[model samples]
Target chain A: MNRAPGLKTYAVIYLLFLYGPILILPLFAFNDASIVAFPLAGFTTKWFAEMWADPNLWKALKNSLIIALSTATLSTVLGIFAARSSVRYKWPGKPVVMGFIMLPLVLPEMIVAMSLLIVLLGIGINLSIFTVIMGHVLMCTPFAVAILTSAFQSLDRSLEEAALDLGESAASTFRLIILPLVMPGILSSFLITFTISIDEFIVANFLGSGQPILSVYIFGQFRFPAKVPSMLALGTILVGVSVVLLAIAEYFRRRGIARTGGKDTGGFL
Target chain B: MTFSPDRPTMIEFRDVHKYYGDYHALRGINGTIRAGEFFSLLGPSGCGKTTLLRTIAGFEGIDNGAVLIDGKDMAKVPANARPTNMVFQSYAIFPHMSVAENVGFGLRRDPRSRTEKAAAVEEALEMVGLKGYGARAAHALSGGQRQRVALARALILKPKVLLLDEPLSALDKKMREHMQVELIKLQRQVGITFILVTHDQEEALVMSDRIAVMFEGQIAQLADPETLYRRPNGRKVADFIGTMNFIPCQILSETGGRIEVEAKGLGRVMLDEDQVPPARGEGEPVVGLRPETLTMLYPGQEPQERAVAGRIDEVIYFGDMTYYDVFIGGTDVEVRLSMRNVPGRPVLDVGTEVQLAWSPSALVLFR
Candidate 1:
């Protein structure tokens, strides 16, 4: 049967409630008044232009870029090796290893962030972008691995065997054939990890020091009302970039899945 | 016990014993394949035909046997390093690649100029009758086109041997027949040893120069298709290769190298001891008759003397032919005969009692 019209209106209200504040941040960055209120005070682009001129903002941006890039590269590489090895051959403790690699995906981020924080402090390793990278890798590696595993599994095993039958060695076959076929998956994994590293706040909050990432910096900017609109402008930019990166990542993911004949959920499932 | 000192043997399985854990896949298989001949390893799925082909292609490693290619031991030879290519059952054409790239992939094994590669790709595509269609992605091609692309990819490399694992199993009947002839033509043009693994009896019969019928990881019979069908080694070979009606029989007497056997359903009849000598005294005697070997006519209507009495239970007319399932002396025997439209023909309907007759030599007596 059909739902009532009131319920549909309620559902729309709920969706607006979720995104209303974040959407307003971009709107008010262009507002004329410095104070962000229900009635947008006036019209101005001073805050957005100032966000560009600030030297510290540029340094913080550079730092975040370095961490996210390293996180994307390192996590994706490690994920590829782990995924390929796990998929191609059956070995003892394979289930256990796979479970361990995937454990971070299910475990609460708070628990993981705190545990990793404790371990670094216990090992006398000072908190920095390196520690932050380690944490991001821990958080994002599972996703990268998960992405590549399905791509590898969806492949026809005979394709590899046919390569062998034609006289390509195991390593050469991987380099020339298997790698190219799953390039979409690898690209998706890289894009996904970069987005996660860029937007992730919880682990970066606890682990970051000396040079804080963009997320922690944004959080630090929340305390001062004078820097409020600038942070919103900055956040507006981050939100836009994250949305674009995530959209690209999702596009690659959906295309990869469709190419491999996998189910497309469109995030509903 | 001298090996061939002439042209190299394309492939050999030397005492190959393969095991998927405890289940034995291949057992002590030792055979040499002559170069440039079409040989088929024909059997049911679990009979290790595909396993044998994969072993030769270096896709599978045996538990005990050595797979040798061109007389060289392929113990540590990985798949790509082996001078053998395969057309897989699914026709593993790279979905992301265009037809040209797929056929040209193996040609990149050694460095070549781009012009040479392009020329070679064009020639290979032309060989498969897909010359100008190289730019289309593999998924866009039809099933038959995909199959040709796979063939071109494997054949273009000029490998020492071409292994086909149930290559035409995915195709429809008409397409399969056309491809079978096309493959044979391609094999003749390329002159490489083509080792086909298939379970389809008609496919094995219609294509291969010689078929090695396997059962339970062992070669049961290896012969040309006609000989294999006509002179099957055992009841299993006879039953698997074609349809033959079997009946329990008792040997009543023996004379002139012929046996008078009393079929459970038919009275005393003389059966010829043909290619397979009838061991009358050993085991339970059985008589096998091809359905086509018997003809049904109305009672007392036989021009000659020999006939078995029967009543037609069903006559299924299938366009060019009709099959009459007849009940003769309490036995249901299937009699297949050609249906030709001639004037004043006998219209034998259901419940029509008739006499089925055949030459005694048509009876394949076995024990």
Candidate 2:
């Protein structure tokens, strides 16, 4: 297929516009000078050392890890139930139920955080890391369900029947056949939900209530000009972690497709 | 076709009925499958053949009847607890497991030691012509190999009855034909009651000792392959089994044990009482003849029994045999007949005048 030279130039410019800011983080992170300016400063590891020394940074990282891990585990478990039932069985109002479960994916994050805040307050619940985890789970479960549903849908129903015909009970068939086949999908869902929860700012800001979550703590650090270089160092490290996580998730997703002998369709990668 | 009539009943369905909401899937199914016999449920799609087979495997429950295996009622039997195994149409080989793991999946609860189970898995694999293939991953195998693995997996349990649901449909034509003969031989070697469900009439006829022809949730006829081909009970069964030329006929008289009919293009003929199957309330009566039953007499050849004058309307040449469509007896009725492409007999062109020889015993009267 032939493409016009003008279209090629436009695509290059579009990609540069998208990724140019992210590319500046590591460059500024390694600079010796604290001020993030154009002229190349001598490379140094001082910002990473400074960032590592802050006790509050460690606390925020711990809190964020707890929230992200909890959200990933809870939402993925819920997603397995919802996805399997949606794919393998028929019931009244199925579409309506699935639609409601997926509605959070499209709802604005600010609205969701605000609504969850109001509900938690009305129920006399304390705002803490636990509440932030709850809000993040609500925000991430739709993504988990969407990923796992495709995995369940690709499975052939006859495999389960064949297992049962071979004298395995329903529960044993699920343990021996269904769980192993969809393990890759479950791993993918866990990684994606963890990444989404860790990087989310609005929900963490609204629900943490000064709990020092990592994303909210980063936003606060930006207010102090002296902390900018260390924050850039942290951002660079985060970008690397997110890339590796998504790469692993995509690998598992592709492996799941191949294991089922299914054609690869669109995925997060 | 070595089925003995004295064999004991393995599975019996008494007034079996199944409904999917408003659609009645199986309407009062009644039949008995004999032990050690190769049986088939043959029908087109949506005819409940697969549903009926599932009933025997205990995968489907009948709404109004009892399913008996070995003279015991199976009303409360679940699929996992039943004494039947199935080879699915998709083969359903577990993609995550090795071929040996899949074949020995049913033996998970067996009391045999590890080495004993391994030997049994090897033996089952050899039974399906898949020895030494057990070490490979299932997803790496081809379609025909997957089918063999599924067969071995199901047969390893030594179930009282083995159900095969269109097991050869996914393979190429040559592979399907090859598997058909293999399945028949395996059924004989094991002497297990095999119940096959297929929409392919030729496959069912080639493999089964007896077959039940079904249409729209009802069995039209349950008989051996030769009886089904020579004497179908209804026009629909006749049409579905193979290519049959239906010629309009009028019943001249009915006697105590004979039926006389004046068939179009063939004049009057006397048929035995058994040749006339029970009426299915179909449209005008017709006499059906298979394409192979009618012989096209070449020039200077004598008619064996009866002959009719026909003009060759069309000639379809196959490598070993040729099919000729001829209009018979100065009438508009066209009947297709097959003639062998033999030495000294040239392929006749269209519009050639020919003599077609047929026997009255081969005609089935359907009303």
DockQ scores of all models, one per candidate: 0.57, 0.80
Worst 10-residue stretch by lDDT in candidate 2 chain B? B273-282
Q: Model 2 segments beyond 4 Å from truth?
A: A252-262, A266-269
For each candidate in turn, the TM-score is 0.89, 0.97
Summarize candidate 1's per-residue lDDT along B1-367 as a digit string, tens digits. 1213355577777889999999998888877788877889998879989888878777678889688888899999767677888888999887667788888888776588988988888898899889898888777788899889998888888888888888888889899999999998888888888999999998888888778999999887877787777767667777888776777788788787777898866667876656344333435777777777777664457635467777778888765567777777757644444444345556568998777776566667777
In model 2, which residue pairs have backbone atoms overlapping below 3 Å? Answer: none
Q: In candidate 2, what are the lDDT values of residues B1-367, reduced to their tens digit?
A: 5678999999998999999889999999899999998999999999999999998888888898899999999999899999999999999999988899999999999999999999999999999999899889888999999999999999999999999999999999999999999999999999999999999999999999999999999998999999999999889999999889999999999898688999999999999988988865899999999999998886778988999999999999999999999999999999998888899889999999989999999999988
Q: Cα lDDT of model 2 overall?
A: 0.92
CAPRI accuracy category, model 2: high
After superposition, which runs of candidate 1 have C-alpha atoms over 4 Å from their true positions?
A: A1-14, A247-269, B1-10, B111-113, B252-260, B269-285, B298-305, B330-347
Candidate 2: residue A196 lDDT (0-100)? 91
lDDT for A97 in candidate 2 is 97
| Recovered fraction of real interface contacts per model | 0.67, 0.93
Candidate number with greatest TM-score: 2
- State chain A's TM-score for model 1: 0.86
Model number with the top DockQ = 2
Q: Please write out the lDDT profile of model 2 over residues A167-267, one tens digit for every residue.
A: 88989999999998888789989998998999899989998999898999999999998899999999999999888878877888788778766677777
> Tens-digit lDDT track for model 1 on A1-269?
45698898898999999999888888988887767787877778889987788787887788889989999999999889888888888999999999999999999999998999899999999998888899999989999999889768867888887666666677888887798777777887888798889878888888886475687777887788878888888888878887786777777767765564446645311
